[model samples]
Target chain A: MIVIHADMQIKPEKREAFLQTVQPLVAGSQAEEGCLRYTLTQDVANLNRFTMIEVWADQDAVDRHNASSHFTGFFKVSTDFFALPLKAEKFTAADV
Target chain B: MIVIHADMQIKPEKREAFLQTVQPLVAGSQAEEGCLRYTLTQDVANLNRFTMIEVWADQDAVDRHNASSHFTGFFKVSTDFFALPLKAEKFTAADV
Candidate 1:
C-alpha cells in the first residue's frame, strides 16, 4: 500500500476557508477506486495545522488520484490557503 | 476513533536497531483488542524517518495500548534511537 502524509499549515485567517475547500476533495478522493482511506485531521495542539492521511492500493491509484479533477482543481488554488509550503511524505508500508 | 501519527527521526546508525525494537511492539499492538491499524512506514525521501500510523477504537483503547508493556518498554528505549525528538500528533477523525 502507498501512504501519503500531507502536512499542511494554513493561514490563521483561512482556517475555515481551508476546511471548506478540502471537504469536497476529501469526499471525492475517498470515493475513488483503490482509496482505502482518505481523512483530514486537525492537529490537537495546533488548529492551523492539518494532515491528510491517505492510503492507496498502489502507485497507479495515487497517480490517478493526482490527475483527478477534484485534485487538480484543489491544486490550482492551493497556494492561497497555505501559511507555509505543504510537506507531503509518501511512504511504502514497511514489512516487519 | 483515535488516530495517532508518531513521527520519528532516527539516528542513522540506529536504524536497524530501531526497526528490530519496534517489530515486537508493532506485533503486540496489532494483537491488542482495540488496535484497528498499527503500521510503521518509512518516508520515501528519507531513510531515517519513519512514522507509525495507529488507529484505535476509542480513547479507552488508546489508554490501554499506552499502558501495555510493549509500549512502555519501547518508550523507555526510544530516546536512544532518535536523532531528534519524536513528534506525536493525536487527532479525532474529522467529520466531513
Candidate 2:
C-alpha cells in the first residue's frame, strides 16, 4: 500500500473555513475506488495542525486521486488557509 | 479511535539493525488486543526515515501498549540507532 502523511498548518482564523473546505475532499476521496483509507485528523496538542493520512492501493490509484476534481478544487482555495506550505511524506510498509 | 504517527530517523549505518529490532515490536504489538492497526513504514525518499502508524481503540489501549515489554525493549536499544530524537504526534479524527 502507498501511505501518505500530508501535514497542513492552518492559520488560526482559517480553522473553521479550512475544516469546511476539507470536508468534501475527505468525503470524495474516501469514495474513490482505490482509496483504502483517507482521513483528516487534528493534532491533539496543536489545534491548528492537521494531517491527512491517506492509504492508496498503488501509484496508479494515487495518480487518479491527484487528478480528481475534489483534489484540484481543494488546492484552488487552499492557498489562503495555510500558515505554511503543505508538507507530505510517502511511505511503504517495511518488511524486516 | 486514537492515531499516532511516530517518526524515527535512523542512523544510516544502523538501518539493518534498526529494522531487525523493530520487527519483533511490530509483531508483538499487532498481537495485542485493541490494536486496530500497527504498521512500520520506510520513507520512500529518505531511506533512513521510518514512521510507525498506529491506531488504537482508545487511550487505555495506548497506555497498555506503552507499558508493554516489547515496546520498552525496543527503546532500550533504540537510542543507539537513531540519528535524531524520536518525534511523535497524537491525533483524532476531525468531525467537521
Candidate 3:
C-alpha cells in the first residue's frame, strides 16, 4: 500500500471558501478505483492549515488519480485560496 | 512499521480549545522513540472534523506512547471537547 500526507496552508479569511471548493474533489477522489481511503483535514491549532491523508493500493492508482479531471479541477482552484505551497510526503509500510 | 489514521470530531466553537489541549501531547508524542511522523488535520469541508496521521516504527512504540503521561493528559481533556468517539485504523504496507 502507498500512503500520502499532504500539508496545505489556506488564507485565513478564505478558509471556509477553500474548503467548499475542495469538498467535491475530495468526494471524487474517494470514489476512484484503488482509493482505499481519502480524507481532508485541518490543523487543530492553526485553523488555516489543512492536510489530506490518503491510502491507495499502489503508486499506479495515485498516478491515475492525479491525472483525472477531478484533480485538475481541484488544482485549478487551489491557487486562489492557498496561503503557501502544498507539501507532501509518501510512505510505504516498513513491515508487511 | 505501523501507520495509524485517527478520525475525530470536535464542537465547532471548542475546536481551538481542543487543539490547544492536544498540541503539547502531539509534540511529546513526536519526541518519543520509534515515532516517525505525527500530524493533526481537519477536514476541508468540515471545520469541526479532525484527523491524525501517525507513523511508528512498530506497535511497541505506539503502546509505550499510549502509556505515557502525555497521552493520558490528552485523553482526559479530549472527553470534554470531543463530539464523537475517536475512530482509528491500522495499516501495513502491501509491498514492504
Candidate 4:
C-alpha cells in the first residue's frame, strides 16, 4: 500500500475559505479508483493547520490521483491560502 | 493492522513548545514492539496544526502504546497547549 500524508499551513484568516474550496476536491478524490481512503482534518490546537491523509491500493493509484483534473484544479485555487508551502511525505508498508 | 490518524490544533504561539514536548513521546513510540511506523507532521498551509500518523501490527500494539507511561507523561504536558480538543480517527485495511 502507498500512504500519503500532506500537511498544509493555511493562514488563520483564510482557513474556512481554503476548506470550502478543497471539500469538492476531496469528494472527487474519494470516488476515484484505488482510493482506499481519503480524509481531511484540522488540528485542535492550531486553527490554521490541516492534514490530508490518503491511503491507496498502490503507487499507481496515488500517481493517477495526483494527475487527475480534480487535483490540478484544486491546487490552482487552494495555493493562495497557504501560510507556508505544502509538505507531503510518502510511506510504503514494510514487508513482515 | 491498525492505523491511527490524530489531528491536533495547537495554539499558534504554543506550537513550538508542544512539538518539543511531544518529540520524546514519538521517539519512544517508534521503538515499541509491533510499531510499524509512527510519524508526526505539520500542515503546509496551517502553521498551528499537526498530525500524528501511526501504523501498528495490530490493535494490541496500539493499546499498549497508549497505555505506556511515556504517552501519559507527554499528554499531561501537551494538553495545555491545544487550541481545541484533539481528534483521532482509526482505520483498518479492507480485505481485497
Candidate 5:
C-alpha cells in the first residue's frame, strides 16, 4: 500500500473558501478506483494548515488520482489561495 | 474522530535500529481499543523521515495511548535516535 500526504497552508482569509472548493474533490477522490482512503483534515493548532492523507493500492492508483478530472480541474483552482505551495510526501510500508 | 501526525527525522546512521525499536510499539498501538489506525510510514524520498499517522476514536483514546506502558516504554526509547525533536500535529475532521 502507498500513502500520500499533501500539506497546504492556505491564506487565512481564504481558508474557508479553499475548504469549500476541495470538498467535492475529496468526495470524488474517495470514490475513485484503487482509493483506499482520501481524507482532508485541518490542523488543530493551525487551522490554516490542512492535509489530505490518501491511501492507494500503488503508484498507478496515485497517478490516476492526480490525472483524474476532479483533481486536475476542481482542486487546482484552490491553488491560488495557498500561503505556500503544496507539499506532498509519499510513503509505503517498510519491509519490516 | 481525531488524527495525529507525529513526524520525526531520525539520524540516518540509526535508521534500521530505530525502525526495529518501534516495531513493537506500532503493533501494540494498533491493538489499543480506541485506535482506528496507527501506521508508521517512511518517506519514499527521505527514508530518514517518518510519520505516524494515527486515527483515534477521540481525544480520550489518544490520552490513553500516550499513557499506555508500551508506548511510554518502547516508543520513548526510539526518540533518542531522532535528529530533530518529534513534531506532532493533531487534526480532526472539519465541518466542511
Candidate 6:
C-alpha cells in the first residue's frame, strides 16, 4: 500500500470551517475503489495544523482519486484557509 | 486513540545502520500494551528521511511507552545517526 501524509497549517479562526468544507471530500475519497483509509486529524499541540493520512492500494489508485471531481474541487477551495503551504510526504511501506 | 508521527532525517551514510539499530526498539514498542501500531517508513522520494507512525490507545498508554526502558535506551544511542533534530506531531482524531 502507498501512504500519503499531507500537512496543512490552517488559519486558527478558519479551522472549523476548513474541516466542514473538506468532510465531503474525505468521505468521497474513502469510498474510492483503491482507498483503504482516509482520515483527517488535528495536531494536539496546534489546533490549526491538520494532517490527512491516506492509504491507497497503489500509485495508480492515488492518481485516479486525485483526478476525481471531489478532489479537484477540494483543492480549488482548500487553499483559502492555509496559513502555510501544504507539505506532503508519500511513503511505500518498508517490508523490513 | 493517540497518533504520533515522528519525522527523522538520518545521515545518508547511516540510513541502513539507523534502521538496523532501531529494529529492536520498533519490535519492542509494538509489543507494548497500549501500542496499536508502530511502523517505521521511509519517504519514497527522500531516502534519508524516515517517519515513525505510532498509534496508542490513549495518553496514558503513550506515556507508559515513553517511560519504558527501550525508548530511553534507543534515544540515547539513536542520536548518533541523526542528520537533523527530530520533529514530532501528536494528533487526536477529530470525531467530525
Per-model TM values vs. the true structure: 0.54, 0.53, 0.78, 0.59, 0.53, 0.53
lDDT of each: 0.79, 0.80, 0.82, 0.79, 0.75, 0.77
- Tell me the DockQ of each model, to 2 decimals: 0.04, 0.04, 0.47, 0.10, 0.04, 0.04
- Give me the overall lDDT of model 1: 0.79
Q: Which stretches of model 3 miss by more than 4 angstroms?
A: A13-17, A94-96, B10-20, B76-84, B93-96
Task: List the candidate 5 regions with Cα displacement exceeding 4 Å.
Answer: A94-96, B1-96
Tens digit of per-residue lDDT, candidate 3, span B1-96: 778888888888788898788888889998999998787777766767877888888779989988999999899877978788888877764323
- Among these predictions, the greatest lDDT belongs to 3
Q: Residue A95 in model 4: shift from native, Å?
A: 24
Candidate 1's C-alpha runs over 4 A off are A1-96, B94-96
lDDT score of residue B13 within candidate 5: 96
**Position A29, candidate 6: lDDT:** 96
- Candidate whose DockQ is highest: 3
Interface RMSD of 6: 15.1
Isolated chain A TM-score, each model: 0.95, 0.95, 0.93, 0.92, 0.91, 0.93
For model 2, the chain A TM-score is 0.95
DockQ of 3: 0.47
lDDT of 2 by residue, A55-79 (tens): 7777789999999999999999999
lDDT score, candidate 1, position B51: 70
- Prediction 2 TM-score vs. true: 0.53
lDDT score, candidate 5, position A31: 94
Q: Model 6, range B24-82, lDDT digits (tens) per residue?
A: 78889989998876767665335687777776777888899889998998898999899
Clashing pairs in 2: none
